[model samples]
Target: MARPGRVAVAVPAALLLAACSADPAQPSRQPSDQPAVARSTTPEPSASPSVEPEPQPTPVAPDDLDVSTATGTVRHLAGVVGPREATGPAFARAADWVARAFERQGYDVSRQRVDVPAGESWGVPVSAGRSANVVATPLGFDPTEPHLVVGAHLDTVPQAPGAEDNASGVGVVLAVSAAVSGRRTRLPVVFVAFGAEEPRGPSDDDHHYGSRRYVALLAPAERAAVRGMVSLDRVGVGATVPVGSASDGDPVQRSLLAAARRAGVPAVPDPGQRSSDHWSFVRNGLPGARLGSTPYAGYHSAGDVPAVVERAQLERVGRLLLEWLAPR
Candidate 1:
């Protein structure tokens, strides 16, 4: 994903979907090894030269959502992994927790293990360690269409509870899986809990080891099987939904806009999220986008606890994911 360029003011799709007004007072957070956080948003972008078609109403309505479950999942994920880091006990536990969640959702889960040799972290070299990714593939779906792999990182920064930074995303992935648990779809969708999205230290380049590896192992045919990648990261603090940072012309972005419109969820496509798991898929020529809010005050800090997470925002993101999974 290229750095989000200046957005055009007049696309109806963007304007209609973006419902949140940027609170100047909202704390500003920089991309943390890519937090997948939004840097800007508007209620009405100026205006565009071309018009997009109006989205159709979806049969799926995100009503009576069990946000309590989503909140509970977040609490368990963030709280259980106390001060989690990629190569620690907490992260291992977190990864297992994620695998079980998908298994409970009826998918066959696989834990892909990878070793990182001694390498620089946060600008300093550190000893090598181990980590793994939790992945699950849908059953009984048509094999020809391609797979829609949706993921959220399971690891958090050192010393941070990281409720919004990522547990929020993990929770959404599980909740949405549950929401659509019994349904069938047009294509297979793999839900993943990515390990090592955050660097073992503050090093920017060291992050996203899991996703990059996943992309690498994809046989040319498997890469061809990838429909698109959608990442849910840090979407628990604001009313706005984080649109993925893929090229505006990417099929993933176009479908998401249509999905948001159908769900009637207010959203703003984030431009500054090229640094997360989604970017890994994009580099392979598959359209990818991350959904999240920006400037979480507690981002990469100790204050990012579960108590501050917004349940409604989690529900909104979950609903949107469910909507996207619907058959065209």
Candidate 2:
């Protein structure tokens, strides 16, 4: 997808959904050798944007949330993405876990395997193993109308336990699934655990393999029916820092802020620019936004593990998301 050239790209729907097969995991297609991690002599981005103070929400006492067990579930999910684990198996396990969690909650689930041709940037190939994207949609909903797509990428950068980077995001997705278990909503909700977000070898724009493929594969009607997308990336702990960032002009941004305030989370608008899974949908004219903390010290490092996440933080973020997604 082309970057927003001062304005969003308005490509024809057919052109946007064109088919291509750039599977990176295939050994036959991999360059005879692997390339070193693409280095950028590119200068660090100009002085980071100043963050706006987020609305200070009344702190809900821990007792307010029955989070002991819920937090355990989050930890278990973090363990599933242990550092050093192969990205393929790790993502597959996370996907299966999501499916089983939804099943236990009585929702019918479906899996969509997307095959996207590897583009210019493949960070570092990890066998381009068979990647799969998981989707679970509740039955008994009107299939003709647009649905809310809540998603997260289950994969991580190499060697990072990705506890805060994403396990936090996955944890939130699963937690919401459980929170709404057996409940009814006016709009169908599709929860997805995407794969191949980490850079692959020799492929540019290969960062979002799983999501890119899924979007490309969606039938025109299906793509058009998407109401909006919310991607959760790194919404874990804060450093007791008093800061937030948000773009008040965007409708999706406004909706998220409204949800945070309604749920009483001390969610300050993250003040800096960000790029995550949400970018994929937004580029496709699908309204979407991401939730995460920047300057994550543990990011892309071996030290990032399940222990890095804060349960209280997770619960608060989870509560805010569930409230936004709760049946209206």
Candidate 3:
């Protein structure tokens, strides 16, 4: 782990600040305060008459798996990397750090650079300067098949240090990589650290540069091969999050529900498709799920620090994800 005091320089292109004329009253959204479980349209194996593999005795409880990793990873990401606003060196440094973490765990890593056209905004008029995406792929026993993508954005809005907004998610991905590396699995896993999820310009749709580009570049065959995808956004916020669907009848919803049941984590359903990195995959016809806590009070302000994160909630997310990603 890097020392907390080692402050890195912010990259000039990455430092595109919000316009001074930007609305001061329009703060980022807060975590939702909804119940943890709701009936959602999660995808299930469509009526196949084929006999399914008998569910093996649960090898390990998902909570146990989550508890083993979430606390430390969330603390480190939220605590160490601190705030990672887009276009800054802190964001770049975090990407590098995550890449190294993957390498140390014996995964083959690759980096894809995404240069946001200057002045590009999702729907907002402001323009973002630049960005990058760091990806790590484990040598899968099979390469022709699409890999499981577990990703978290590395950037945050300015003003606050986005510890819970994303540092927590990054930590969970790192911890999961470490935990699953040696254990044999049927599918390949890709851990990606996305840049510029925060609105670079004014609109929300333009914010997910890293993910949008990655999804766009994948071959159609590759895109269709995706078994399941999960985007960990703001997972560090300490709350019992009701899992939501990008769409009401999306297939990913079924996987999450089953995972919650298998992992024994209490989760509810949400129908709203709060824009996040997962939207990229959704556009490409991939089954994707977004996991997050309800709105928090201090989402974009300076108050979103490590202390604000709920360790137990993070564990629930991690454990459920493990169940979802575990061999079916």
Distance from true location, Cα of 174 in model 2, Å: 0.7
Pairing residues by index, what is the TM-score of model 3?
0.74
Residue-by-residue lDDT tens digits, candidate 1, 191-226 = 888877876544445668888878877777778888
TM-score for each candidate, following the candidate numbering: 0.76, 0.70, 0.74
What tens-digit string does per-residue lDDT give for candidate 3 at 32-61? 885345445687767869778966433333
lDDT of 1 at 246: 52
Worst 10 residues of 2 by lDDT: 239-248
* Candidate 2 residue-wise lDDT, 33-123, digit = tens: 8754554678888998999997642333222334554456557666654642224566667678777877886777877775534322223
Instruction: Please give me the total number of clashing residue pairs in predicted model 2.
Output: 20
Deviation from native of the Cα of residue 179 in model 3, angstroms: 1.6
- Candidate RMSDs in order: 32.0, 33.3, 36.9
Candidate 1 Cα misplacement greater than 4 A, ranges: 1-65, 117-126, 140-145, 200-204
Give me the candidate number with maximum TM-score: 1
Off by over 4 Å in 3: 1-69, 118-127, 140-143, 202-204
